[model samples]
Every structure is written in structure tokens, then in C-alpha cells.
Target chain A: MTPFSYTRAGDAADAVRLGAFGGAKYLGGGTNLVDLLRETIERPSALVDVAGLPATIEEREDGSLLIGAATRNAALAEHRAVRSHYPVLARAILAGASAQIRNMATVGGNILQRTRCAYFYDDEGSRCNKRSPGQGCDALDGFNRIHAILGASADCVATHPSDMCVALAALDATVHLQGPAGTRRLKLTGLHRLPGTRPDLETALEPGELITAVELPALPAGARSTYRKVRDRASYAFALVSVAAVLEADSGTVREVRLALGGVAPKPWRARKAEDALRGGPATVQAFRAAAESELADAAPLRDNGFKVELAKRTITAVLGDLAGVAA
Target chain B: MAIRINGTETRAPADPRVSLLDLLRETLHLTGTKKGCNQGACGACTVLADGERILSCLALAVQFEGRSITTIEGLAGQDGMHPLQLAFIEHDGFQCGYCTPGQICSAVGMAAELARGAPSAVTTDLGAATVRFTGEEARERMSGNLCRCGAHNGIIAAITQTYAGAAL
Candidate 1:
């Protein structure tokens, strides 16, 4: 790894100022940042470790969960309020990496985690637009199985590898930020951008912006939500197509449904089209399949990843069906 | 920065980027923690950070300033070996033994979590702190640690026996 000056951020203001000093990266859990550093993908001149910040989870009087950005994944997953109110978030986080990683990774760092694109990690000689702008995308043709199937542009086809963000999307969470300019709040959907013209600009944060906390608005009362991830093996693998379904049915009719897909898009895709089809509709396997197909109709899969369409359709159907009590 | 590892409070070397795995193995001359993937994928570099298991390879030594870290070298007593270590030997839980240190350290942390009533993904009630440790639970929790020697069955056997003994 490259030799860099390490400074501990005394507060959020200090972190932002240090970050604005230029060529400095804020280190949270150091899971992905350290890995990228070792691989020479990221070469920052200095690192500001912000792990000592007050990263605790708290419940407000309004039943909202204000989760500290520095809160570790293990702590968030095991939090009593989070487990009871937003079980989907807990389950999604637990389905990721491993126990050891969950213990190390922070909530903000996990959401800011980079794509697992093989081409992007190829420091030797792979044309990855995300790693280097104006470069060609090798995943468009080579070993494109794990490439994005949605919201992908010609310049890049890398899927966002975050299960927690998918659940946050379904829960309608907002990210609280503190930067040199000021403080602001942005929706989860507005945080991660698509691999459009600027695949390099992955997030909406400014250079010196630091995420302080993540706030989850109260979930739908008595909503049966679950996160189902499909990977090659049972655990320790990235998602092939993960679905976070938050559903509330009334007398066998879908009252409200929120659907988000991971590993299929450059961002945590909120499947509003699918949700529109399922809402107020009969909660059946056929209806679920149609809803999935309706949203996936926009999918322009590559040759190697064409099978993802079918897998996504099946996953959507299965997850919704499980919540709806349908034989899938 | 100084950290308490295996009950000993020690200072780290000069490099700020040195990982906790390297600090323990290379700097402290404690080779109990092994480095496999160097990334977080392989649990071969597992160690306890404040009684919770973490990937030491992915952890910067500077970040662990005043925390208490426990490695495989701290698991046993002066008399013999830790129960988990003894169970591993009895079940032949290793072949080449390259991943044994990390596996044992991870198991130690896992038992602490179970004792604390932490729940896994398979838990039906997410809010229910108490959990039942079954073979399936062990498999899912231990998925981060890979054993190329395929000594998985024996590893499971040792963990299972240890859990049973602890319960008894």
C-alpha cells in the first residue's frame, strides 16, 4: 500500500475541512478503501479516520430510526429497534459479505462501497470507464455475466453491489450529510447515480461531503417485508439478483408494495413500474410474474447476462409470492 | 498508537497503512493470525476486535488505537488448550492447518456472540436476541472463512462439540 499521512477527524467539521484540503479520503471501516489502496486503484495523499465518531443508533419519538453513518453493519443488524421495525434492512445486511466483514464495515462505507466489476479491479489492463473515465468498457463483451442488466449505458455496465442500500431504497430512507458547504438530506435513490455519461461520478456527494447519518422514515404499519438474495452459493458470494420486497396486503389485495432490485442496475433500482402493477391487484403468482415482466421489459441484457432477466423475473415472483402466500 | 492484544498492551510500528493482521504477525511477532486473501473475502485473517470478530487484514492498525484485540494465540491457558482448540484436535478439524488460527479465532468470537444472544439471518424473529446454534447456523456464520483442504466436516464437528460442551 502507498504511504499516506493518517489524521483522526475530531469532528464532522474537521473531517470536511481535512477532506477539502485535497487528495484526502475519509476512512470509515476501511474494508473497500483499504482494499482499493492495496490494489492501487485509489491513491489518496492522506486518510482521515472517522471511526471514533458517535456512531450509535437511536429511535426518535416519531418511531423513526436515525442510524449513524459510522455504525457498523453488525450493530445495525442486531439493533433491537431495527430488527423489530425494519427487519428487511437487518436481513439484507446480514445476507451480505460475512460476520467478520459485517463487524468491520460501517453503514456509510457499505453504501459507498464500490462495484464488484472485475474489469474495474483489473489494474493491469482492463478498459473500465468507472475506474478511468473516457476509457472503454471491457465488461460490455468480456465475461459480462455479472454486468448490469438495468440503468446501464454503453460506457459502463457495472451493477451496484450493496444489499443494505436495496433495503434502504424500499424503506424510503434519507441520507443525512454534513459538508463544508452545509448540511443536507437526500433520498436514497438520489444518492447513487446510474452509469450514464459520467460513470466515474458514482455518488451525488460533493468532494468534501461526509455522510453523518441515515434516517429511515416509519415503515408501513404491519408491512411484511423481506430481502431475498440469489447467489451462486448460499453465502459469502455477491448477489446474482437480490430483491427487497416491502408489501402490505388487505383481504388478498395488494394494498401497497415497494420493490427494489440489487445486482441488476447501476443503482439500487426502485421498481416503481412493478410496484404500480402489483398495487391494488390480486396477490397471485401470475400477477407477480406480470409485474416483474412489466418492469424488466426495459432490461437490455448483454449476451452473457441474458439469463439474468429470467432469474430476476423468478426472484421477483418468488419473493412477492412468499409474502402473498402463493405457491411459487 | 497502542492497542491491547491478547491481554498485552503494545504499540504499533511506524507505518500508518499496516493492517492489523501484519501488525500482529509481522510487527508483534505473533504469527497466529494468517493472511489469505488480504481482502475481506477470506476469513483466514480473522481476529477479535473488542470481543467481536473482524477481518484483521482489512483493518488498519491505526484504527484500532485503544481497542482490545484477541488473536488465536490468546485462546489457551497454561494448563493445556482452549476447549475449541482441543475439540479441533480431537475432530481433526484441519489438514495443512494454514486456516486453523483464523477459524479458531472466528469460532471464539462466534461463541461470544451466541452468548450475547445475537441473531443470524436465519432467525425467524429479528428482534429476538436469543438464538439457537445449529449446524446450519454455524455453516452460514462461518462462510467467510474458506478451507481449501475441505476439512469442513471436521471443523463443523469441532464447533458443534464445543457448543454442546458450553451449553452443558
Candidate 2:
């Protein structure tokens, strides 16, 4: 790692103030940032350590779960409240990285973790728009197996690699941010930005802003949720295609459903069409297959990743079927 | 920076950029913890903080001030080896032994979690307050600790045999 100055922030204000200085990065967990620094992909002059912030897991009066940004992934997964109430979130965290990485990775760091695009990490020689703006996206044409098929631009096609964020999107989780502009709340679904002309800007978070916490609202009664991740290996590998689903079944009919896909989109791909197909319909495997096909109808897969469409469709069908069984 | 390692409090130069892995191996001379990947991708530098497994490579030395840390060296008692350590030896749970320190420390923490009835992702009943420590459960919990030596079969067998008769 390059030499850099570090200051442990006394409070959120101090973190923001320190971060407002040019070439400053908020250090949470350091699982991703420190690695990037070592590779010279990120060269922040100073690091504002925000790990000591008082933010932690708490239950709201309205019965929603509030997760502090600094809350470690392991803590969040094992929290009694999280395990009982928001199990989808727990499942997502469980499917991520590994036990050791989860212990050091924070919720804020998980959200802010850059894409795992191989080209982006190739510091020696590679064209990556996310790494260096206006350079180019090498993955667009070469070895685009894991590239995004939804909400992608010509500048970049790298898909978001987080399993936790896909569940958050399906649950409509809210991101609570603190910065120089005081406190602000944004929907987690809108947290990521599409790679338009400016592929460099990845998130809605402004410079100097810190993610304070994420709030998960209560789900409807009879809500059954599941997160299914498909990876090359059984463990310790990034997802090839993952699905997060929450379904409400009533008397064998799907009353409501929310679905989101990871590893296939620049952002979490919310299966709005699939959800619409299932709502108020008879819960059946055929219906799930139809819904899954509808969701992937517009997927434009690259040469090598054409199999992803079929794999994702089968994965989604299987997830819906499993949840339907539980509902039954 | 002050930290309590293996029941002893020690101090190091206040270098915030130094990783806890470096502090243990370089500053404290606790060479039991190996560095496979300086990045957090590998669990070769796993250690315990307050009995919880954490990647020391990703952890800053400054963040662990005053916290109790335990490495593989602390596993054995003055008289003999810890039950898990002995079981590992009996089962030949390692080859080359490069990833042993991290694997053993991680298993120590994981075994504790099992005793506490932590539910893993593969747990069938999420509503079950307690989970059984079956071979599958052990493998799922220990999935983070990779052994390039391909001793996973022996490692899993060792942990299973050790905890099989226990309450967990």
C-alpha cells in the first residue's frame, strides 16, 4: 500500500470534514479499499477511519430493523433481531465472501465495494472505464461472461457483485446517509448509478458523505423470502447469477411478490415484470417459469454469457418454486 | 498501539497503516499466522479478537487497541494440545501446514459458534433456535478456511469427530 495519512474520526462530522479534503477516502473495514490502494487502483492521500462510529443494529418503534453502516457483516448476519425478522438479509450476507472477510467487511464497505471486474483490477495494463474514465471497457468485447446485461452502457458493462445489495433492493431497504448536508435518506434501490457517459460516478453518495445506516421496513404478513446464489464454486466465489425473492401467498394464489437479480445487471435488477405476473395469480411452477421467462425476455447476453439467461431463468424458477412450497 | 495478545498486553508504534497481521508477525514475532494473500480474499491470516474470528490482514493494528487477540500459538495448553489441535493431528488434517494456523484458529471460533447454536445458511429450519453440528454443518461453517493441500476431507472429519460427542 502507498504511504497515506490516517485519522480515526471522533464523530460523523469529523469524518465528513476530513473526507471533504481532496483525495480523502472513508475507511470502513478496509477489505476492498486497502486492496485497491495496494494495486494503485485507488490512491487516496488520507483515510478517515469510520469504524468506531456509534452506529449499530437497533429496532425502531415501528418494528423496522436499523443496521448501522459500520455494523460488520458477521454481526448483522448473527444478530438475533436480524435472524428472526429479516432473514433474507441474513441469507444474503451468509452467501457472500467468507467468514473471515465477513468479520472485517462492514455494511457501508459492502455497499461501497467496487465492481469485481477482472479488467478493473488489472493495474498492469487493461482498459476499464470504471478504473480510468474515458479509457475504455475491455470486458465489453473480451470475456464478458460476468458483464451486465441490464442497465448497461457502452462505456462499461461490469455487473455489481454484491449479494447483500440484491436482497436490500427486493426489500426496498432505505439508506440513511450523514454528511456536510446533515442527514438524508435514499432508497437503497436508487443507491447505484447507471454507467452513462460518466462511468466514474458509481453511487448516489456524494464525496464526503458517509452511509450512517440502512433501515429495513417490515414486510407484509405471510411473506416468505429466499436468496439463491449460483457461483462457479460451492463457496468463496462471486455469484454468476443470484436471485432474491419475497412472496406472499394466500389460498394458493400469489397475493404479492418482489424479485431482484444480481450478477446480471449494473445495478440490482428488480424483476418488476415477474412480480406483476405472479401477483393475484395461482401459485404454480408453470406460472413461475412463465414469469421467469418474461423477466429475461429483454436480456441481451454477450457471446460468452448467453448461457446466463437460461441459467438465471432456471434459478429464478427454482427460487420461486421453493418459496411457493414454503407458502403451501 | 496497545493490544492484549494471548492474555498479554503489548504496545507497538502508533502506525495506523500497519495491518494487524503485520503487527503480529513482524512486531510481536507471532510467526504462527502466515500471510498467503495480503488481500482479505484468503483466510491464511485468520485470528481471534474477543473469541471472534477476523481477518487480521484486513484489520488495522490501531483498530484493535486494547482488544484480546488469540492466534494458533495460544491454542495448546502448557501441558498438552487443545482437543481440536490433537484431533487435527490425529486425523492428519493438514499437509504442507501453510494454512494450518489460520484454519485452526478459524475452526476454534467456528466450534464456539456451533456450541452457541448459531444457524448456518444450510440450516433447514430457520425458526429452530438451535442447530445440530453435523458434518454438513461443520463443512459449511469451515468453508472460509481454504486448504490448497486438499486436506479438507481429513479436516472436516477431525472437527466432526471432535465435536460429535459434545453438547453442540
Best of the candidates, DockQ? 1
- lDDT minimum window of 10 residues, candidate 1 chain B: B159-168
* Candidate 2 residue pairs in clash (backbone atoms < 3 Å): none
Tell me the tens digit of each residue's lDDT in model 2 across B1-168.
479899889884465678889999999899999999888766889999999898888787877876899998888898998888888899999999998889889988887777776777787766677777788888878888889989999898888888875877
Task: Give the per-residue lDDT of model 1 (tens digit) for A79-170.
Answer: 88888888889999999999999998899899899999999999788998889899889999899998889999999999999999999999
Candidate 1, residues B69-146, lDDT tens digits: the string is 988998889998999999999999999999999999898888887877778877777766577788888898888889
TM-score to native of every candidate shown: 0.98, 0.96
TM-score of chain A of each: 0.98, 0.97
Per-prediction DockQ scores?
0.86, 0.65
What's the residue-level lDDT of A324 in candidate 1? 82
In order, the Cα lDDT scores of the candidates are: 0.90, 0.86
Badly placed stretches (over 4 Å) of model 1 are none
Clashes of 2: 0
